[model samples]
Target: MTTPRRFDGRRALVTGGSRGIGEGIARRLAAEGAHVIVAGRSLGPAQEVAGEIGGSAVQMDISDAEATMAAVAALGPLDVLVNNAGFDDFAYFTDTAPQQWRALLGTNLEGMFACTHAALPAMQQAGYGRILNIGSEAGRIGSKGNAVYATTKAGIIGFSKSIARENARYGITCNTLAVGPIDTPLTDAARAVPVHGEKMVQAMKDGTLLRRLGTTEEVGAAAAFLCAEEASFVTAECLGVSGGMGISA
Candidate 1:
């Protein structure tokens, strides 16, 4: 007998899938035979990524609760939902403004909640769903100049566990992947500066067990497996895609 395709006939929605890790995950899912829907704040970038992968694209800001809900409703039943959209502000806790905190948390935690809440009904009705949240190593071990970012990522782990426990009976799996540093546009932009950029890059490399940053392909592989049918038994767990760096939370 032929082996089953991990995600054959499946439909997946990946938020912030226009670029970076999100885009990588989207492409990986599609390669595994799932119909991927890429969503992001901008249509141009999202559509470009989708076109490259032969997937569909939808412009949305996950930070907006109403927009997230509407997008979920419009997508209907989904076999997989990757909550990869998130926001971060590299600031000391003392320097973080109240408004910035709200914005950061809104996109990272609240936005995730809205999307997951909206997707629940469809998943419950369908009786099969995979939910993967893109978290960070900083969430697990904490980091300097990124207190809010760390907290928000940490929140995702807790939130995902709760959802997993509640939905286990419904054949729904919710898990978070705590990713380490990777070479991406985000990092590139940060490093474009002088002192701060250099420091960030060196610190990332030093913190990693591999002494090198992670790759988009590596993260994509992990995401693909989590969203696969074979991973049904895996839920309420935090998987570290980090190169043996920070490994808790």
Candidate 2:
């Protein structure tokens, strides 16, 4: 059977599209016939992914409001916008300093604000759009070591809902994808830490009903569905691609 090209003529921008979950989403959209622009902090990696996927690349540090705004504006209008760029570190609330909190907030939360703000006008004008924000299950059920990161994810849920409400009349949909343990570079790095790395990984796996980590492709599939035209009725919802995390077996 042939895969449906849900985004045959759409234009999509996936922030942090150079690697991990972002990269996965970009590839999925492109596979479905969308012209994707892979945005990242570095030009090299973004270009690499875009080249492979027959998409395009742009350097966008969403944390820099000015740069993000300019970059999105240059693209004219987009049919899909995936606010997947984010940063996080495993540290207890008390152990983290102000700078650490700022770093997390800037990219995970404020960055979403800048990118969404920049893209909303065009989406509204077009009267059709799909906005997907990458959140975390940690946001729904707080994690032990990711206090600030959880906070940002929680904020994303609220942000998505508000955006959905405001843009519904324009035929635009906004939703959050709250993911669980996924085998990505970020997770690998966390598990590479000297003492607690393996323990942390095991704990996360154990917490999920699946008793294992998820795959990037899994996330990509979920995102594709939510962003598809068939999902026109779905908006302001938080969909969990979380391997049943936080659920009792």
RMSD of 1: 2.2
Worst 10 residues of 2 by lDDT: 240-249
lDDT of each: 0.88, 0.92
User: What total of clashing residue pairs does each candidate reach?
Assistant: 0, 0
Model 2 misses residue 91 by how many Å? 0.8
Give me the candidate number with maximum TM-score.
Answer: 2
Per-residue lDDT over 1-249 for candidate 1, one digit per residue giving the tens place of the 0 to 100 score: 432357778999999999899988998888878889999899999999999888899988988898789888898889899999886666668977999989989999988998899999989998889999999998899988788889899999999999999999899999999998888887786576556877887788889889888988899999988889988789998889889887444
lDDT: which candidate is best? 2
Clashing pairs in 2: none
Report the Cα lDDT for residue 70, model 1: 89
